[model samples]
Target: MVQILLSLSIFFTSAAQAAEKAGMPQLDPTTWFPQVFWLLITFGFLYLIVEKIVFPRLSDSIEQRNDHVSDNIDEANSIKDQAEKKYQEYLSLISNSKKEAQDLINANKQSLQSNFDNKKKEIDKKLEEKMKEVSKEIDDFKKSAAGKIGSISTEVAKELVKTVSKIDTNNASASSIVEEVSKKYLKGLN
Candidate 1:
């Protein structure tokens, strides 16, 4: 700040001296050549510095930034493509898992159906055997009852004969005739 103030004071002092000596501050024809010469020198110096140093560095910085932006864009595009591939892979995996699960369920269903059929067949076979046993038992009971009925009929016939003839059947000795009559009557029933 102090240097800038000192320079400004010197410039104003020079300008006041020229104004006093030339009687016109800036439009004096006698000083025009020197002012034009200094102006040209300042512009030439500024132009040389800008062309030699500032412009090349500025252009290099701009190209570097552009290259960085381009590389970032390419990387982003590549990552997007990879993400799309991964998404397709994930979808395929889900589809395959569903198909596998369905196949397993179908196999289990078939196995269970076969097992159920086997159990039903076994139950039917057991029921058939039990029915045959019950039928045989019924036939045996019928035969035993027929034999008891024949003996019961003979006793009844002997009692009836004794009652009507007023003779004691125990002394008549005709039990064999009653047994023959009972057998013949039983044969007629068959």
Candidate 2:
């Protein structure tokens, strides 16, 4: 459309100039040759400018844009690979840390269990010794109590015999006195 308008304007200007000049007269307006000639010349010049200057610069700009896009894509891919590698490394580190923690916990648990077992055994041994000591003390107490009871009974029997003898002095005879003397002598010997 621009080409057509420019050709018409050129033809009109050329016709007006020819008309003003007396040497060269204006051509017939009824013929289409002048319009056609001007249209061809303008179009030919536009084609040459576009092919030689405009199109080559546009192609260079397009190629530069494509190269920039390709470089950016490649850089993005490298960054993504690096990120993946770092993530994998972090995961491996975490996994190893967890494994080490589990091992430490297990070792501590075993150590604690062994310590508790040892303490329990010591407590049991001490308890057994305490029980034996208590049993020995009880046996000593029983023996001492039995000896005191026997001494008390013997004193009571002696007091009762002296009272009976004083009450019945006439009935108390010489044979009885001799028998009591012999019993005292036998007890002293034991």
Q: What is the per-residue lDDT of model 1 for residues 46-129, given as tens digits with 9 covering 90 to 100?
A: 999999999999999999999999999999999999999999999999999999999999999999999999999999999999
Candidate 2 residues lying further than 4 Å off, grouped into runs, are 1-31, 164-190
Q: In model 1, which runs have C-alpha deviations exceeding 4 angstroms?
A: 1-24, 143-190
The models' CA-based lDDT, in order, is 0.84, 0.80
Give per-residue CA lDDT, model 2, range 1-190, as digits (tens).
9999999999999998977774533455656687889999999999999999999999999999999999999999999999999999999999999999999999999999999999999999999999999998997986676555555545555566669775433323533554465457657955
TM-score of each: 0.59, 0.58
Best by lDDT: 1
Best by TM-score: 1
Evaluate residue 76 in candidate 2 and report its C-alpha lDDT on the 0 to 100 scale.
100
RMSD of each: 9.0, 12.4
How many clashes in each structure?
Answer: 0, 0
